[model samples]
Target: MTDDTPAGRSPSRRTLLKAGLGAAALPFASPAVHAAARDVKISMQRSSVLFTVLKVKGTLAERLAPLGFTPTWHLFTSVIEPMNAGAVDIHADVADAVPIFTQSARAPLTFFARERGSPAAEAIIVPADSPIRTVGDLKGRTVGVSRGSGSHYVLAAALKRAGLSFDDIRPAYLQAPEGAAAFEQGSLDAWSIWDPFLAFAEAKRPVRAIANGTGLTSYHRYYLVNDSFVAAHPKVVATVYQALVEAGQWVKANPEAAVALLTPVWGDLPPAVVAAANARRTYQVEPVERAQLGEQQAIADTFLEAKLIPRRIDATDVRIWTPPAVKG
Candidate 1:
């Protein structure tokens, strides 16, 4: 199962937009192609601070224009679905735990870049006035979380640390927006969520962090491309990666500009909330380091133990995008 996609000349936009092949997903490992290109199909969740910056800056489009890569972005709350469906070529700002599930399913995904892990950015929150104070108190309570999300892993790990399991707690699976609403309406005892949402909840209501990713999960947001997509147009990955790095730097150095541009797009995410989300994340994007994949493996093993994924996964075994220069 190797993608022996030839690497000679750069592909045009027509070559890049061809989506990944589906169906073998995660039961076995195979080589993913990331060489040819037409237009780059990308997906970004709303809370992906760095990608949101990219969307706002339009830098990827500008950089890719000369290469004949038309950038198409879709908003999908979850990370793996679009890639799994072959509807997107690239998905950025995903969590460490997500690709593990995809790899478990043997899907065609390549983690091209990684951000420095920052553990405190995501947390399980309860109303500040609520009686539940710690992870132990969550037993038998209805908690909201997005299935297969970083927050989901955090919540599970937090429960295990407190001597509880998923069965001990009533888990309500909801996307980010719905979870926030459910939490606000007092429908959930606790909400496990990540930054932007975590920051939004904190700013909109009085909430207390019951547990964060610290000592539990690395919470490293990732940039992934469809296995075939990367094999088809590896340079597209490189170009986008470079743009993300610059945008991340610009975001940190100019908070006001970042917030002002994103506030409206983020459904009126307050300047403070947007700022907090950015502050918690490291925007420095670089090629994925093989040694650093242990955090992902931990998440996969945890999911396997909990049966969230059908089987075990060696997360480090999947495709990783190294820049062409590195490859040469």
Candidate 2:
């Protein structure tokens, strides 16, 4: 879908006001109240579509900054690295990553928000010259991934759909940047990753897409926050979600403008690549549906079956925002 949404154009004042009313409904506490509250920090991955919401001078920061909230951004090479470190209040990446943390005896995190569409953002790519034509070609070969991420789950489900398992192939656990370099070096056989990085690798290397997470995996992006953060500042939580949703809507309608914003944010990425990536995604933030939950929970079960996680988790408890409340 080509979205020629012009830049420098703002959504009408009426729309902004309605969004403000939505923001007003959020549980924002006064500064005096916030002063007495604990400070919470948020960590975001560098290349994930979620960054489109967090870019410097981006719509997300501009909207939330005025709300008396300060977001401290941490750039991790991969999603799971930040989550496992326990370094931030909320981790934003694929929704599937949440269950891995839940199943590991870690505290069950609250599901704050979700991207309406999967990342036109991530996919599995192979060298054009390679013999691999379909998912089945992955048998007995090494697939690179950053373990415990949406990309990780994408590969897991892809393998299962192909009548294969993690054991059928060698898993090279590496962060995305490293994985990209490995792919270019020909040391990595097949690589699965999220865009910007996926776009980056595909630009320099002649690659054939094996499969995207779209059909095989639930492409929902989730915000995972500690329970304390959710309980203490429900208002701030809603504010963040609203800003993200607005930004998402903007990106959906204006692919070219979205690419222009990302070009500087992503640092000189070709316009075509950014546009291509943006075109494949839907940016709305909403609660996960039950069917989406079951698909993701099945991934958690697969992780347990693969011994990637310590034990089985219920997966349902990770959801903090109920669907009814998400309906606007």
Candidate 3:
């Protein structure tokens, strides 16, 4: 009301209430009801070509821009520690068994996307000149591997297939780089590792593959998200998945370009090394199928039989992100 309409009397309660509400709705509104939306934090493994491309091409951020998502990429060599500490919202191109092992520690992770395993990429490598010819020869010898990795299971499975177990070999649990150095220094008799490392070593040195994943393990890689992130943001999960799937297809069609894109990000490794690594991988991303997770169950059982995981996990019983239907 104007000052002329109210000399010494205050405005009506209804008028005051309306004015208050309008003022509150104005541009200078109170700080948001919740914290400002933060950029989606994604964890990328150094050797994950699809994620490397995503970061290099800067397309994921553009795809998510309309929704106000700033994609923040964090480079990591492994995800367990980051997942445990909740450092990233999502992790892509992780070994299928890695998440299962994380589950044993009770990390709430959801399976979101998958890339079929290529056994050729994950192998047990020994020096070409080494006399250890068969899996059985691995008995009582020093084998370097990173604990809780896909190769961890591979070492155990290969030994088991040869009528042995982890106990049969002296396990040297070391990261790929460290293991590479050790293996080069003649400290390790053999190294069980996955692609990029497997690919790099083979190309740069005189290493021979004792065995690959074919009969032993599928070596499937998966995209995982912290349970809380997917629960709070389903659409965000879909966006990430679609981006990865497309990127995977691009990598499959353009292996050389994939390597070129990944080289700089991967510390300028040789183009041939990157291409070989990409060649050894099946970059075809697909939806997570519950019925087809028998291998996952197998991985869980393998870990359990070897006392790697604390308990048997169904592997298929975790939260899975179903992509939203495409709009017409």
Candidate 4:
């Protein structure tokens, strides 16, 4: 699983062009012969604001068109299932902990890009009026969280920091909406989740954060591509990576504009809530480096100790694709 090439070194642009232009110069082909556009299926989730912006703006499709590729977008509640099923070519973004489970399942995915850690982005929150005022108070209380999510790791780390274990709390495995409903009904002691769900809940309800990933986890989100797709379409991968980089930059540079663009598609969440959620995120996309896998390894170990994932895995032992060098 180790790469012979130096870390951060990927196939060159020239090499990608050569690979993508296969049979274009066939001697027997007519002068008008052209390659049919291949479809690149991309998975999108509501929480991934950059991908949402790209989809709304048609940025990815426009970028891929010149490469003779057509972009096909698919929405998913959770992308890991489809990704493991090999149903998509690219996954827009997913929590840091997600890839670990995928890796344990031996999914053929390659990390291409990642947003920098935004520690405050995910948290464990309890009702503001609840007697549970701290992470330690949840020793025997019911906590809600999405299984195998970044917030799940946040809950685990927060519990461990408070000298508790996953067994200390009764976990209610639920999606964001379901967890929100349970929390509202006073059925759960605390709800562990990420923004804009976190932001939406805070704005809509009276909940106080007991602990976010601040001192525990980095909360880095990643972009991945199918390994088979990476091999057959290196140039397409590069294009998608660059587009994400640009999209990240755009989101950071124009916060108000970005929120305006995302409001409609984000389940019509309030602008203030969206902005608050975005403020907690760095939105700075960078190439995935092996050195950054330290937190990933920690996440894997945490999940393993909790018996969440199936088996142990070397988090760093995975494929990483570097984006092509930026042109002046």
Candidate 5:
């Protein structure tokens, strides 16, 4: 896999391994005994630090071992397209707005888990010396943002709150690394992005956030699975969900340990920056509920209004998988 580092620098093999470019197939039961164990392919992103922790700890693999399955992790910079195409069985997590775009494409996917809202985790930022002090100042300025990312919605909502519209700005659709490069090179007037990247930029450069998704959006992240995977391996899905819940609890209870484990995998980000980014995320994994989809619907509507999505869609129309109840 290619390195995600900005500025066209190549990553060493060791760094790539640490960054999870090499698929991690955790050991199951005795090799001789479970030689035929099925592989449960899981896709992970650097921002989803909980999955990084779990992958490093082999937590999901351990949990699925008894079910005759071994966990294999594949790192990804963007997960929606691969997920929709059935390239991965489970998507670690993605911004709230991602699933909406996937659903609009009629992808057969199901929401299994979500992190509670951490609205401040994402923001619209400008260089410290830039004259764009407020969201209204963004009108007609070039803004760098990932197309269909949660930060995209953050920019749109922030603009609307300031009485501006999506069409008022010139958008540079870019991934995190490219956006950072452009923003630092003075090519972009502003950038809309989420943490670790957000935290990393602040540490390396002078920037200021003009607005984040506070009242505008909850910024909840969601985990999804291809519907075919759910049908073929319901029990495995349940086990993975339970593992995520426990992993979330573990990360919250042991922040320092989580940071230490994640720093290397996240491109050796400083421990402090990793902690700051983690601080902005709730990481409280919970089952996706229909009632909680209000923000999702709002996101879909906003994207539709902005003409970012191809067509209108009912955000709650997708399938949801509920975990089994906990035993006393």
Candidate 6:
């Protein structure tokens, strides 16, 4: 548990629990929770990662708690690790990973929720004063990204669109927070990262976005479940989606309050950055679209070219999707 300050400072989860619970301020109505009062056990990852914002707001649990469903918070450093090990039933992640996971497994993971038209939620960043003004300038410069994550895909796509190959740049493999710190320290030329880490770096350091999901692709965030989870309790899935859609709408409408609510989870990171990132993000619960499939196919092809994935895969074969009506 780290401290709750977002300035790359520590804000332990335990501290937030103490403070938020002490206030005893409940945020949701009972019907939201009671929908599954006795049938489901709902939980979420409790890390500072953006996908877990639902847990941070305490709204996800608040919505599900009174339903007789208690949310057990499982904290992990890497999201993929938990998803792979089956430690968590449902994983909220980016669409990029689906290409890799689908290529490797049978009956691939299915997405139930997507954030549509959320441009600039992810980006390649450098100091505002730095001379690297455009994507073309990124060539031959050091670009940092997590080896097997959404940021990695964004960097690949951005570089490809710039008519440059991965060979043209010095790639630094690092996690979001690590890469952000390196960029801020001037040790790295550019960092490819997702929010609120992206937001945090931009505010605390001299960083500016060279490019985001614009002109490249829509890097969507997804809520994925095992095919079995979808099979057994479809309504549970729909309920969660409905709650998330409501939460996302609330977030878009009340950025300041949302930031304050998330501060306990993000360690009090700067509110303006969070708000900016939120404003740029479209947190909608839409079904995965055909374009997304094409984009994911492109990602898999790129990863194959980069030798990141072991083999090429058909992006569509792994998907298990339901109609928009089935979701919130």
Model 1 over residues 1-328: C-alpha lDDT tens digits? 0110111222343333232111212111112323453556676565556765665566676778778776766655455765566677887577887787778777777888887787888899999999998999998999999888888899989988899999999999987767877888899999998877788788877899999999998778788888787787777888988888788788879878988986655555458887887788877767788888887888888888888998777787988888766675
What's the best-to-worst order under lDDT? 5, 4, 1, 3, 2, 6
TM-score of each: 0.86, 0.79, 0.86, 0.87, 0.91, 0.81
| Residues 247-301 of candidate 6: C-alpha lDDT, one tens digit per residue | 7777777777777876555545566776776777777767666556777777788
Candidate 1 vs 6: which has more TM-score: 1
Which has the higher TM-score value, candidate number 3 or candidate number 4? 4
For model 1, the superposed segments whose C-alpha errors exceed 4 Å read 1-37, 325-328
Task: State the RMSD for candidate 4.
Answer: 11.4
**Residue 175 shift from truth in candidate 3, angstroms:** 0.9
lDDT of 2 by residue, 68-183 (tens): 66555554444454455566776655545545655465654677677765644668889999999988989989899877767787788888889989989999997665676678
Which model scores highest in TM-score? 5
Error of 2 at 100 (Å): 2.6
lDDT for each residue of candidate 3 in 59-138, tens digit (9 for 90 to 100):
77777766767676665555677776777888757776787777777787888888887888788999999999988999
Q: lDDT per model, in order? A: 0.74, 0.64, 0.73, 0.78, 0.80, 0.63
lDDT of 4 by residue, 193-266 (tens): 88877887788778899999998888899999999999899899888878888998898899999989876555
Off by over 4 Å in 2: 1-40, 58-67, 81-86, 289-291, 322-328
Candidate 4 deviant stretches above 4 angstroms: 1-35, 326-328
Question: What is the TM-score (0 to 1) of candidate 6?
Answer: 0.81
Error of 2 at 284 (Å): 1.5
lDDT tens digits by residue: candidate 5, 1-328: 1113433233576776646643333221222237888888787765767777777887776788889998777766666677668787887588888998889888889999899999998989999999989999998999999887899889888887788897888999887778878888899999998887788778778889998889889988899998998988989989888888888899889999988987777667778888988899888989888988988999999889888888989998889988877322
Query: What local lDDT score does residue 91 receive in model 1, on the 0 to 100 scale?
Result: 76
Q: Is candidate 1 or candidate 5 better by TM-score?
A: 5
Q: Please provide the root mean square deviation of candidate 5 (C-alpha atoms, Å).
A: 3.5
